[model samples]
Target: MKKIYYSLLLTLCVGVSGFSYALQDAKNIMESVKYRDQGVDRYSDVDLIQTMSDGFVRSRSLKMYEKEFGEERKGLLYFTEPSNTAGTGLLMYSYAEVDNKEDDQWLYLPALRKVKRIATNSKEGPFLGTDFSFADIERMRIADYVYTLKEEKENISIIEAKTENGLENPRTGYSQRIVHVDTDKNIIIKDEIFRQGRLIKVFEVVQLEKVNGFWTVVEAKMDNLVEGGSTRLIRKNTQYNQKLKDGLFNQRTLRKGLD
Candidate 1:
């Protein structure tokens, strides 16, 4: 069996991205965020710092790479720091909203010596004992939720969306997400996730940069409201269009890791 004790040390999320457009309805704004141009290929060194409710802290390092194939986006990550967590990797493939396709994900746990596919129905679980869930890491489906333009506050557009089937949907446990989008850049700068009318998680961008003409998230934080802890994802040496090889995104890479 896989190492249950180390499962929390074996995973991570990719970039949360978006683009620019004229102000319109909620769907239009979200569409812009979902379809933003990231880049042809990219790479970065990432740090995941977690602060527990009891005041303990843990930090992990990762090598992250992303690339675009037509309209689909693929990303790969390899954990490289903290001896016990090294060699852990995650691979993801996200598609356009128009295709109505489900994004795919796989996690390689070094202890298990196997790459496990993340099922669509199990995306709600937390990542690396952090506040961010697998669903938060995956590409957001425009069809899965119905959005409404709640209000406009200065440069931020406050919008809310509810899962189509609500509580009955096994695909995601969170029934609602209230997103704060940058009105000018058309990107999600913050998000508050809710379950059964209770606020449980909050994600906010700590820093951003225009790298190689592409908007990139330099740092972000996910706070677990219910759990009283937080995770800060800090990106360093972020670069766009590295012409990353196709070999980096497959399951084989997950097992071998990014060298």
Candidate 2:
């Protein structure tokens, strides 16, 4: 009778521990989404125009200077033109939280006068030349993805954020990502990419100094362990909640500037 009682107690304890862990995982995932959503919402508010503008300026100015073979480098060699870049440009979009959609466009080939619409399916591809993918631009609601609490220890909740079609690959198909959420900041501080349940890539982000009172991503790096190559992206300007002009996002505006 004593042995039976002890066995039951142990089983009960295990079940309770599992239940607690599941609940905590749910909470951690929820918190991660909440924090990201709040930050994005705040970023869209018009009240942060000044900060946004500052970030824009700094981001545009971020560049690496390199001397040419014959010393021809002089001005604006490292910084991209934004309009002519292959995968990057000034993002002009309107966020629709109520509808869970984003109306966004990109301006490329300024010399030819072209503006292209951003498709929902292509959100997972890299943004411009940076390591950031288009999905990184818009914010998603917390309830959109299914959450699994993978681990919990040392006051840190380990969550895996998985959504059906979470990552869209234009050329291939969809990809799955397991993100490690930082409970303290409610941010997805790290991620491991898997394709068909096989490890493929690892992504990391480092928080830098605040720009315009908003927590900004200072350095981001993505490694394709299988490909033997990596990309590093760094952002200097990060401003939130600024008034944006309607025409500024237009293709014509991209060619004409803020005139």
Candidate 3:
């Protein structure tokens, strides 16, 4: 009996140690992805296509600008196509200081001719009638989640993440996310979003290439499982580390449209 008891205890110890190491490895991988240096500024023209359940498709075009300021990142997006959405714009500022402060977001509606601040409670709403939420477009902070390695394949590592450190918004759409990371490149290739323990959406990186020494996703798709629809975002004419004006990301620029 003594010999059998010792063997079981030894096995349990090894299992626990392996689990701890896996968790640490998953966190390290996520940190690499979150902190990867893209560039100081980036500009891109994007095509947004939304496919409906009844086989209808709508398309729009957007001009996007991004810049890094200290630890904060600013983004501006302006619609350029579909006449009706031509002047619609969104401005966002993501802060590195995580002290219970939410990110800043603003929307400019051409019909209203005004800029409206997006409240934290409404960040979970679909972005411009697309499959992506406002929160999805913002930068993700590493400290906001606890990650564990679920599985590791030869080319990919699957990590399950749960919100921590008061990072989850009460009104957010997703409760947890399962991410498939490219082990070699340390980039997120796919994500499964769960809402109340039910899988609601799947996001996939369909194409990726290195742009100015940074890995960039050129084509991506988001499928809404419950809604029976999908949205595809394709990037073209991408330029990185450009000299974008600081004033372009402000609300004034959003309302006026990029000069």
Candidate 4:
């Protein structure tokens, strides 16, 4: 009887220890994804296609430049297509999860001849009528959530992250998210965002490839489950370690247009 009792206790301890390890491992995995290497800088031409539920489609084209400075990242998108949105651009500054700093975003509209800053409270809205939100482009902060390993496949790990900050409305606007990570590459292959216990948005990778030795998402899509629309981003001519000038990432470039 004593031997059986000791064995049961030992099993219980192992189970608890395993669960703790899983939680810690999930956190480490997410951190790695957030800080993946993509060289010092990257440049790409992107096509944004939006498909409405009624079957109508709209498209735009932009030149994207992103660079890393220390632990922070900065990006600039200069719209060059459709003539209407030509010369329009967005400048973003992103920080690491440990800092928990709110990202800065500025949108330049040539028609208005003005540069508008995205308020911290207004990061939940869509990005220029596309399915991807401004916060989505800025990326989510990992410090505000707790991650749990839900499942592990051959090369994928499903992690469920719950917000513990307890804000009624967080910057990202989603309360919880299920991230499907490619364990081998430490890349987020898909993201399922939830709000109020319902799935409202999904981001999926349509194409994944190694460009110039960097794991890149050649194409991706964001689907709005509630509104019945989706947006796809296709990257063309992606080049890494471009030695892009710092001047290209500033508000002046956004105003004057990318050279």
Candidate 5:
């Protein structure tokens, strides 16, 4: 009887330890994803001009309209908004700044010829008519998700995360996502999106390369399985901490620059 009791206690202790480790691993993976997903590495008060190559190609159908298959729209994409596009042009202006817990963004539209102020609450809108939701673009805060370490082996970590308020609407979107992370560089390799209890999309970071000792992505792709559409963005002419002028992000400055 004494031996049996000791065995049960040992098993229980091991289980508890395993659970705690899982939780910590999950949190770490989520933090890693959040860090790389946003342009956080770029210090505040610097402006960046990224030439974009964007393509709206669908294998099935996305919108309520009509589509058979094999349709795509290619254009230049540019933006400063965290969750939306402020403007798009051959020459675009973007100002990035981090204040407190949130990052602020501003875009100077060459067409409207005005500087647009993107509010924090408005980050949920669709970006530039893309199938990708605006919420999909923002940096995922560590506080928003509950993490669980699913597995770790071969120098790689897999974390399963369920975030509160993850689904912004009643569209039956994702409340959880599983992220595959590279332990060596703390970079996110892939993410599986879930809606309710089903998988709906897969987001992948591609063309991972280091520039000037900074880990950066040359291409990022998101595919919507339910909608049968995908968005691909390619980045070029990327530079960090260019020491942009303070007045560039302002409305008056936007107008003056164009003038």
Candidate 6:
């Protein structure tokens, strides 16, 4: 009985140590991906194409701008195509620290002629009929999730993450996510979103290239596994470290089309 008790205690100690190491390593890998310097500011024109499983395609033109202030990142996106959506805009501010504070988001609807604050609970809703959700566009805070290293490959590392208690977004459609990161570039190459242990969506970086000293995804796709639809975003005319005007990210500017 004494020998059996000692063996069990030793096994438990090893298991606890292994779990702690895995958690720390996962956190380090996630931080590298989050804090990898892109630039002080950026601007880009992009095409958003939504395709149905039936082969129908719809496209929209968009202009995006992003800037960093201290540990906070702000971004703005405006739609310029499909007369119906022209002048629609979205503004976001994400913080580096993942406290109880929620990111701020706003949407300008051309038809409504008003800029509306997007509720934090609505983060999981589809963005303008696209497969991508508002949460996907906003920067994810590392503290909001607990991560575990799933697999390590020659060039990619797979990490499994789930929302941490007290940091869970009630409206988030994903209960967990599996991410494949480029070990060299610290960029996410793919993500599989799951709800209740079932895969519901897949996001993939179709193409990437080094632009202005940063590895940029030139083309990406988000597919809704259960909905039978997908959205592809193709970047064009991308400029990094540009001197973006501060006012461009304000609700006032969002309501008014770019001059």
| Location of the lowest summed lDDT over 10 successive residues in candidate 3 | 165-174
TM-scores vs. true structure, each candidate: 0.87, 0.60, 0.91, 0.94, 0.65, 0.92
The clash count of every prediction, one per candidate, is: 0, 5, 0, 0, 0, 0
Ranking by lDDT: 4, 6, 3, 1, 5, 2
Q: Candidate 1 vs candidate 6: which has greater TM-score?
A: 6
Model 3 scores a TM of 0.91
Question: lDDT for each of the candidates?
Answer: 0.83, 0.49, 0.87, 0.89, 0.53, 0.89
Top-scoring candidate (lDDT):
4
Off by over 4 Å in 5: 36-124, 164-173, 245-259
Worst 10 residues of 5 by lDDT: 60-69
Model 2: weakest 10-residue lDDT segment is 44-53
Predicted structure 6, TM vs. truth: 0.92
Q: Write the per-residue lDDT of candidate 4 for residues 1-259, one digit (tens) a residue.
A: 9999999999999999999999999999998898888899999999999999898999999999999988888999989999988888999998765676778999999989999999987888999889999888885577868899999999999999988864424677888889999988889989998888889999999999999999999899999999998999999999999898877888888888755
Candidate number achieving the greatest TM-score relative to the actual structure:
4
Q: Which ten residues in a row have the lowest lDDT in candidate 4?
A: 163-172
lDDT of 2 at 109: 48
Query: What ranges in model 1 sit over 4 Å off?
Result: 1-24
- Residue 215, model 3: lDDT of 83
Give candidates' CA RMSD values in order.
14.9, 11.6, 2.4, 1.7, 10.7, 2.2
Q: Report residue 21 deviation for candidate 2 (angstroms).
A: 7.8
What tens-digit string does per-residue lDDT give for candidate 6 at 114-220? 88888978988989989999989988778667899989989898998998752444656677889999989999999999877788999999999999989999999
Encode model 5's per-residue lDDT on 1-259: one tens digit a residue.
9999999999999999989988986786666654443222232211222222343332211111111111111111243344233333211222122322443334456567765655656544545555455456544556546788888888678888786655633322457788888877787778888877678778788777776576766677777677566666555545544443433333454445422
Q: How far off is residue 202 in model 5, in Å?
A: 1.2
Instruction: Give the higher-lDDT candidate: 2 or 6.
Output: 6
